[model samples]
Target: MDWPTAAVVIVIAVCISLLIIAALAVVVGGKAAKGLKEFDKPTTRHTF
Candidate 1:
């Protein structure tokens, strides 16, 4: 439990947490985009 070793461990832990968060964000965002796309529809106009 030297200072350098503790620092390295802390940094690694932070990096892993950040990676997990990023992955979850991508998954959730993709699902949200898919849901929005499903509700998206094209509009048509009729003219005389």
Candidate 2:
């Protein structure tokens, strides 16, 4: 591929990777929050 085309493809790939990572982080964080709630007595879980 040409230089400009290659650069565009790389950027698109990076953006998609970032988005997937962000989604996974959200899922994991929510699970962690729920786990932490178990340690706290009497408070609402308030999970996602």
Least well predicted 10-residue stretch by lDDT in candidate 1: 39-48
TM-score winner: 1
Q: Write the residue-wise lDDT of candidate 2 on 1-48 in tens digits.
A: 899999999999999999999999999999999888775645554432
Residue-wise lDDT of candidate 1 within 4-39, one digit each (tens)?
999999999999999999999999999999876766
TM for candidate 2 is 0.80
Q: Which candidate number would show the highest lDDT if scored against the true structure? A: 2
By how many angstroms RMSD does model 1 differ from the true structure? 5.3
- Could you estimate the TM-score for every candidate? 0.82, 0.80
State the C-alpha lDDT per candidate.
0.85, 0.88
lDDT of 1: 0.85
